[model samples]
Structure formats: structure tokens, C-alpha cells
Target: MSRYPLRSTLFFLCPLFSGLLACFIWAATLPPAAAQERGGGQTPSLGFAPRPKESAPDKELRFLRDSTAAAAISADELLEDRERKRVIGRGFADLRFLGKRVQADHIEVQTETRDAVATGNIIFQAGNDRIVGSRIDFNLDSERLVIYDAKGYLGATYYITGNVVRRISVDRYEVIDGTFTTCEGDKPDWAFHSRKSTFQIEGYAHLQAPLLSLRGVPAAALPYAIFPIKSKRETGFLIPTIGYANRNGLEFSPRFFWAINKWSDATFGVDYYEKRGSRYLGEYRYILSKDTAGQFNTTYFKDKLEKTTLWDIKSSHISSLPGGWGFSAVTDFASRKNDDRSLERNLNDRVRQDTDTRLELTPNLKGIPGSLRVAMRRREGLRENDGDLFQKFPHITLDVSQSQIGSSEFRYSLGSSATSFYRVQNKKTTVLQRFDAAPSVSLPVQTVPWLGVTANFGLRYTYWTDQKRTPDVPGNPSRDDQKQSPLSREIWFSSLGVAGPRFSRVYNGGFGPFRDFKHILSFQTTYSYAPAMDSRDRKLIIPIDNVDAFNDQNTVSYGIVNRVLTKLKTGEGFETRQLFTASLTQSADIAEARREQNLSANPRRPFGDVVLDIQSRPISLIRFTHEAIYDPYEHEIDEQTTGLLLEGGRNWYLGLDRTWRRKRSRGRDPQSGRSDLNFSAGYGLTRRWFLEYLTRINNVQNITLQQS
Candidate 1:
């Protein structure tokens, strides 16, 4: 019964499934044959079947095939043999493997070994290297190549040609009977030929038996030469500089650089002058740390004509340490024998040779209240003209903080110094040692925003050890007492009070090109009084330091300052600028009335000269400045100077200056003046050309004194 049931079920389902299969076959065959051909017919079945395990030889062969097949090979005609695993391509054959490409007229490749040979106009390219040869043999898997009768371009900036070329790696090559040049075309402007040469990419080239040629003509020969192929710092001989000057005749300077380490380098050079003697120069640079660096240079020459040896040395160093300590030193020293005749023609060199050398070290301490610093310095000078220099060997100074006084509004400061001033001239030395201490306290009171006042009191004390030299008298017999050493001390006190009121206003209306305008007016009157010292105390005091005895003064100085500021809108942002400023100052001596002046019993004049200063920039391109000192009592201007500057587009500029000095002698005319005028202008004639002119005129003499 079970068998019969199963048979029945199959009998019913079999016919239905047969009918569906027949329908599918009919539908598949319904497309036209032409359509099937155009679509390349049905795709072959990719069966889901496991492959046999590969043997070692099979795996090796597969690896070689894969390496060779990584790139594509194409040709107009191709012949392949599967049995031998070889391919032969002709008629414009090309191959590309990895990043290397090769094109040839005829090519042969062995897939199993990944080897290739090409002949007849072969061109190969890899990275920046391009090679053209008659024949090439290459191994794809090893990336080794050998070329015969090859010429190539290296980095597109250099050319190399050789009878035989061998590539060792991507960045290294060896050539036999090769020529190298930076020029183009059949005949280059300059070239080097060598018997054997080796090139390292982005590094350098080494040549054996190199001969330099210019325009196909041999110029120089070297036993062996090493040249830089990359623009990097390396230890090498630099290109010699050749020049000719009227004073030096033909000059040749050759330099050699030594790359001592990553942070230091030195260059040594020799300059040969055909007319003059040779000069030796050396420069050294070092970077000790991020914030510490230094340079030292020296130049020495022996002049045959002058029969003297001259040398100049310059060195500078700057260092910053932790805890706000800093140090700097600059030294410029030159030979003293040729002060009148300098070996260098540059004015700046001559000035440096005559200048002094200075070294300084400073340590600072900072806090919320203020900062304090201590400095030590040394100075030395060279040349006869610098003989009067006040040499300070290890002068020390201390500046204390300006701290608040006991939590009050007053602030106090202290400054002290000990210095030794010495002068050496004509084999004679004079020295003066001094110690100075000054302490000051100030209270700044601001009753309102517009009004402010400050009261200050200070005391200065100084002690000096002095050396004096008296002048020789023609008819006196005190020559033996010309030298004396005196010790002295002085102390003084000073008090000062300053008060001022400041006013400012802003206007919102647009005026011409200005978007807004403001006016600031400040007026200040200062009255100072100090009583004269006693005659007895003044006689015992000698002024050896910068401090002087107190002088009797009772004076009032008044000043008015006016400023006009304008705001303009710019493409980037709003800009505020001061358009104009004017100031006037005058003083009156209050105690002058107590002095008797003339035979008519008139009191002395109390008013001093009036000073006016004005600076204005009415337009963006023009500016004017004027300053004058006027004696109101004499009705004359003592000194006056006015300057005007105009700047325009594209290097166009003009400047005019005039200065006038009036004679102060009583017999001279009050209005008589000596005037000088200077004019300078610069204009662009073209984008690359410009014209500049400068001239000075003596107006009183009606003559042009200088023009350039």
C-alpha cells in the first residue's frame, strides 16, 4: 500500500514538472541568432568546483606569471606558445609592469621566468627616469635592467647618455662611457664626460676621469669628481665666484663648506686678487638650541702695496634661559694699523671696524606688582678715532620693582648702579668709578575721568672716586699737580607734581571721505619750584656724575594739545587714524620778578619763547608738518622747519623740506634768516624702471648746494 501511494504521487507531479521544463527550453530559444551573436552569446558557466592542490613547481610558475602579468602587454601582432610559456610581439609592441613602461619595435617575453628582451628603438620610463636604447634585457620579477647604446633624461632637468647602462635599483644606476649635461639639443652648452659614473637619485654623482666640455670643446679635466645632484646642504666645494673690479682687478674666491653636524656649519674661503694680495675668510654658524644661536666671521688680508696685514672679526650670540635670564654679545674688531686706509670699500664695513664691541647679561624677576632686572655689561672699542670711548668693563645695574606702598595707592621704585668709566688714549688711561642709588615714590590720584594728578618724591645718592688731569699752563709752575685723585659724595632730594585735564568729543556726521570724526583737546599747566642750595655746600660739591646740585626754579609751563582723529571704512575692517595734531607750549618764570635787570630799574622779563608744532594729513596721499620756536619778546622766530610729503600710486612720491635759522645777535636784523631747502622725488617710468632725484638748495646764497 505504501509503494502504491508513492507511485501515485510521482505520477501526478512528474508530468507537471516536464511541462514546465519544455516551456523554459522553448522561451530560451525564442531570441534571434543575430541578437545572440551581438551579445557574445551566453556566458560560460562558472562551476562551483574545488580546484586541485598546486605543487611547488606550479606555485612558482604561478608567482612568476602573476608578477609579469601585473602590467599589460599589447601589440599589433602577437604570437604565444602555451607549451613553452613564451610570447613574441612585433610591430609597435608595448609593455607596462608596475610603474615601469617599455615600448619597442620587437619584443620577446618568457612568462614562466618573467624575463623580457626588446630590440629596435626601445623606450623605457620609470619615475622621473626615461631611457631610449637600441636593445634592452630586463627581468620583471627582480626589476633589473641592462641597456645597450642608451640615452636618458633624469628628473627632466638633466640628460645622460652611455654606451652601456645598468639599473641596480629604483634609485641607483651605473653607466660606462657616459656623458651628462643640463643642456638640451644635439650639442649642449656644457657637459661632463666620464669613463665610469654612478648616479644616486636625489643624492650625488660620482665620476671617474671626468672631463668638462663647453660647446663640445674640452675645457677642463679632473682625475675624479663628485657633484651634488640634489639641492641639499652637504659637505662639498662650492662654485667659485669670479669678478673684476677697478680696485681689486680680477678676483677669484673659492669656498669650501663643512657640514659639521645637523646644527652647525662652517665655510672657509680664499679670495685672490691679481692686483692686491690674497684674503682669507671664514664664517661659522651654530644653533645650540631653539632659543640660542650664533655666527662668527673673520676676514684677513695682507696688502702688498701697503705692506701691512689687516684683519676684521665679527661675532654675535644670543641666548635665553629659563627663569627670565638672557644674554647677548656682539663683537666687531679690526686691525688698527690701517685705520686711514681701509681694505674694504663698503662704508658699513669701515663703520663697523671703527665701532665698539659690547656684551650684556640680564636677569629678571617678575611678579604681580611689577618686574625687576639686573644687568651686567662690558664694552671695548677699536681704532684711533674710537680712543675717546668711555670703556665700561663689567658695569652692573639693578632696577627694583615698582611695588605698591603698604597696600596704599602710592607706588615706590628703586634703581642702583655701580660703573667704572675708563678712557685710554695716547697710551694714557683715566678712570672714574661711581656708585648711584635712587629711590622714588609716586601717588597718582584721579578725581574724575577727565582730570588726573600725580605727586612724586625722590632721593638720589652718589659716591665717586675720581681721577683728574689738569691742563698744562704756559706760564704756570703747577705741572706736577696736574694729576689728582679725589673722593666725593653727594645727596639730593626732588619733588614734582603734575596735573592735566583731557577732553575728547566724537561727531557722527560723514565729512568727505571720513565716516566719522573725533576731536581731543588736552590742556596742562605745570608749576615747579625748587629752592637754591646754600653757597657753602655748593662750593664743596664737584659734578663728576650725571647728577647736579639743585638750581632755584619757580616756573609755570602751559601747553595745549589738539588732535583730530578720523575713521574710514576699509575692505578688511574699520580703520581709525589721527588726521591732524597741533600743540603749543610756553613757559613763564614766576621768580624772575625778584631780579633787578636794567639801569631803568625794570624787572627781568618773565615770559619764555613760544613753541608751535603742527602735523596734518588732509588727504590720504599728502602730509604736512611744521615746527617753530618764536620769541614773543623779540618778535622773531628763532628756528623753523616745515616738511611736506606727497605719495601717490605706483612708486610716485615727493618730499619737500625747509629749515630756517635766525641770527640771535643784537646788531643783526631780527628777520634775517639762513634757510636750506631739500627736495626729493621718485617716479616710475615703467614697471621695471624708476627715476629718483634729490637736491638741496641754500636759499640765502641762492645756489644749489647738492644734487643727485
Candidate 2:
């Protein structure tokens, strides 16, 4: 047993010992050799596997490999065929190239050709555009895509759907069998369907064979059309205006605008009235420079109901020239086939058609301190029964500045004019030529801050050439007579002297809403004198204007003025403003006393009417004005005018006026007077709504004369 046990034990122990020795040798030798073989004779460590030594070329190669991996396209599922250089992906595949992204349920890419195809719910996104298509074929390098059955959104306001769409560039696209609409819905409010369309980003869409549909109903068709997708100024059709008027009935006006250039534009409009006929209107606007702008408009209408043709032309222009010269012209001319009854039905239109036209040019004299104005004017009446009309074809005037007399206080000025007047009545014409000139000199003296005086002396001369008039002619006067009189001349001299004294006082810290209040009082007296010409000689002069021979008279006019000023705080800053002005004027005619021209067989009274004027702005939004002439000799009010204006909240305004004039002679009733009351109000109801009313009432008759 002992021998067997020993042998068995020895056998187990020997095998165990032999296995442990072989394991140690195998472990020690195997690790070193394997490490040498794997790491190029480098020792292995227990802390971590020894890092392989990298050379410059290896480092560069590894960096390149990592960059390539980063730029490579990734997908959830990818199937690659190396031989064909093709890749196929399914289930939520997405690819990004450039700045755009493409997503689809299934995608196929050709690596060599740099092209891709996507099907089943494909979406493409670039910039603000997101396009969805059933199938898409795109070139990766070229960034060109062809989408089938695509619907895309441009910005947020526009939508486009097409059977096929080709992306030409980032800002351009070509669509076939497409519909474009600004409205968002399955059923759009308005849409344009085109067989072929080309879109340019933020510009316009060119459509071939476009049909305009409203509420899914085809409303219009065009061979080719350009739809503006921008808010900038472009040549296009404007929205039509539709309304109904009582006089003109239903009206529809459509306009077309043409942008000629950056400085000019034109609009052509057509207005159709159901009761009346159509009207064509055209307007042209231009701006040549900063100081030059103009507009010309014309309207032509043929009324079928009234069987009349009406036309009106209006033009206005203002231009500033070099060397302090300016030009302005306004022309308003209208013509009708018939009388006022057959003219425009609206009162405003009738008034506009009867307006006058004028043109003026002002030029600065080079060496002289003056300006010259040349004007042309024309007028035509449209009333049923009107009298003769006087018109000036062209008028020229010169106004010179006041010149000093060698540092003296005396200044002189000259004003001259030449005018041609034409009078037409009952198919007859009369012409008159007149020339006038006036020169004046003034001397102003201020002895102190409260005392001032001004003396003015003037001479006026007028010459006129007119047809000779025969006295005691039994029949009507013939304006076509060839007889002419010699040029008549009238000369007059006048002098005026004014002396005044002004006084003012200021009070502070007492007035409400005003920091300082001032009161100014002034008293002035004016004395005018001229030698009268003979009455018989004055009868020979034909007056064409206001200049006439002076009457033999010595007059003294006295005026008293009171003005109130205040310094107040406003929203912007401190302001100094005038609050009210009150004035009273009266004159005494001394020459009437010397002539003894009193018809009442009483003492000759020299005192004339006393004029009272008051203008007051008591508050920021209210104004009151009163003017009256009181006859002190007769102890009566001759004339009176009063006005009140109120500007309130919510853009509301109200104005009231009262006027009264006394009759010169009392007929049966001593209190007979003519009086009128006018009331006007305007209110803004809403942002785009307004209401205005104006009415005049005759006080004596107790009736409304006019209301608008």
C-alpha cells in the first residue's frame, strides 16, 4: 500500500510540478517574444499596452484618415457595393452637402458620379425654403436637384406645388405643372396655375399659360404672365377701386403703372360708370433733381346719358434754377360740349372744371437787389348766365429792394408792372393795355426804446391805352371799333407820417401755467396828405388798376394796440408765445370839413368809423377773433365779424362764424341788416374714416343757404 500510495502521490505531485514549471517557462518566453513580434521589439507593460512609436509620416497619415472619416456621409443603414461605387440607404436616411440637407425614407448615391436619388417622402432644405417631394434626383457636386411631385414653401407667405421642379440655382427654380398661392390652406383663396413657371427668389415668377383661380374657380387666363413676388416698385397692375355714387352710379376704376426709370413713372387708368360712360385718365410724374418735381394729369370722358364729351387737363411743376431763379407753372383747363347743366353731375367736379390756370417765373437780377416775375393767366366761366370776363394773358412785374441813402435812415423802393387785359362778353372782345410804376422812400427814426417814427413819401404814375368811348351813344357799345385814343397818363404824389410810442410791463409768479406774462401797449397816429386834381381832368383818366389820382384831403388816423405775451412750458421745451392782440383805429377827415360836403344841413363831422379788432388764443386749442366797424357819427355798428375755432380731443375740430353788414340806406325799416352764420365741424371716426360738415345760415331769413 505504501509503495502504491507513494507511486500514485509521486505521479500526481510530479505531474503538478512539471505543469507548474512548463507554465512558468511558457509564460516568460511567450510574452517577450509575442511583445517583440507585435510591437517591433518593444517591451510590454502591465499598466497599459505600450504605445506604438509614430513617425511624422504616420502621424500625418492618421490625421488625414480621421479628417476623411469626419467628412464622410453617415446614415442609419447603408449598403455599399465597392465594384459599382454605389451606396443605398433605407429607413430614415439623411445626407448633408454644402449648406443644404436632404432626408428621405430611401436614398441611393453614386460615389463616382457624385449624384444621388431619393424616393418616398423626400425633403430638401436650403435657406428659408423647405421642399417636399415624392422622388428627387440630385447632383451632389453641382447641388442641382430635380424633384417630382414637389410642394415647397418660400419664406412664410408663399407656397408652390408642382408636378416636377428643377433647382437651377440657390435663387432660381423651374417648375412644370405648378400652382402658386400666397394663401395657406388645402383650398386657397386665390391661386395661379401655370403649365411652366420660373421663380426667382424675392423677385418675380414668370408663368407660361397661367390661369388665375379664385376659390377654386378659374377667373382669368393669360398666355404668359409675370407675378410680382417682391414689395419693391415695379411695372404692374394696381388694385382696382370700386364704389357707388348717387350721381355717377356704380364706378370701377383700374390703373396700370409703368416705371419708366428711376426718376419718372406713368399711370394709365380707366374708370367705368354704369350710368354714365367710361373715362380715361393718365398721369405722369417726374423728378429731375432735388429741387425739381412735376406731375401732369388728364382726364377724358364721354357721357352717354347726357350725350356730352368732357375733358380736363391739369399740370403742375416747380423748378429751381441756378443763380437764384425759380419757375412754377400750374394749368387747369376743362372743356365741355354743352352748358353747365350738361357738365359733371357732382358739384365739386363742376367747380374744379371752372377753375383758372396760371404760370409764373421768377428771376433774380444779377446786379440789382430785386426780382422779376412773369406770369400768364387764363379763366373761363361755366355758369348759365354770366357777364363779361376780364383776363390777363401775360403780366410782368419788377419789385426792387429798399436802398439806403449813404448810411442815412432813408430807404427807397420801386415797383413797376406791365399788364395786358382782355375782356370778352356776348361774342365781343375788348383789349386794354396799361403800364404803372410806383416808387417810395421811407425814413425811420427811433429816438428811444419806447419812441419811434416813420415817414413815407411815394409817387405813382399810370398810363393806359384803350378804345375811345363816345358819350350819349343810343345803342350798345361796339368793342370792335378801330378808333383808339392817345395814351393817357396820370400822376400823383402822396405822403404819410406815422409816430408811435410803445410801453410794456411784465409780471411773474402769478399767472397759471405761465412763468412770465407780458403786456404791451402802443399808440400810433398816421397823417396823410395829397393835393387833389380837378374832377373834370380826373374823368378823362381810365383806371385799369387801383392806382388813381389822389383826392384833396388831409386825414389823421389814430390806432391803439394792446398785445399780451406769455412764457409757458410745453412738451418740447419752454416757449414764448403771443396770447392776444387788441387794436382800435379811427380817422378824422379834415378836408371834408373844409369842403363843406355835409348833406344833412348840420355841422360837418370829420370823425370816421372806428375799427375794433381783437385776436385771442386764450388756450392751446381755442381761438377767437372779432372785428367790427362802428360809426361814431351815426352811433351804429356798420359791420361786424366774429369767429371762434375749437380743436378738441380725438381729432375733432369745430368752427363758428358770424357776420353782419348794415345797409347804407334804411328802407322802411331802420333796423334792416344782412347777417350770416356759418358752422363747420370735422371729426375723425376711425383710422381711415372721417366726417366733415359745413353749413351757412342766413340769420335774417332764418334759412340754410348752403350745406356740405
Give candidate 1's whole-model lDDT.
Answer: 0.67
**TM-score of candidate 1 to 2 decimals:** 0.53
lDDT per residue, candidate 1, 225-303, as tens digits?
A: 5654542356665545555555557777777888788888888889998888899999999999998999999989988
TM-score of each: 0.53, 0.58
lDDT by residue (108-169, candidate 2, tens digit) is 87777768898988887777667788899987656578999998775433578999999999
Query: In candidate 1, where is summed lDDT lowest over 10 consecutive residues?
Result: 1-10
Error of 1 at 700 (Å): 4.7
Which candidate ranks first by lDDT, i.e. highest? 2
lDDT of 1 at 686: 25
Off by over 4 Å in 1: 1-285, 297-313, 334-354, 366-386, 424-430, 467-499, 529-531, 534-545, 548-555, 588-609, 617-623, 632-634, 646-654, 662-676, 679-708
> Model 1 misses residue 236 by how many Å?
12
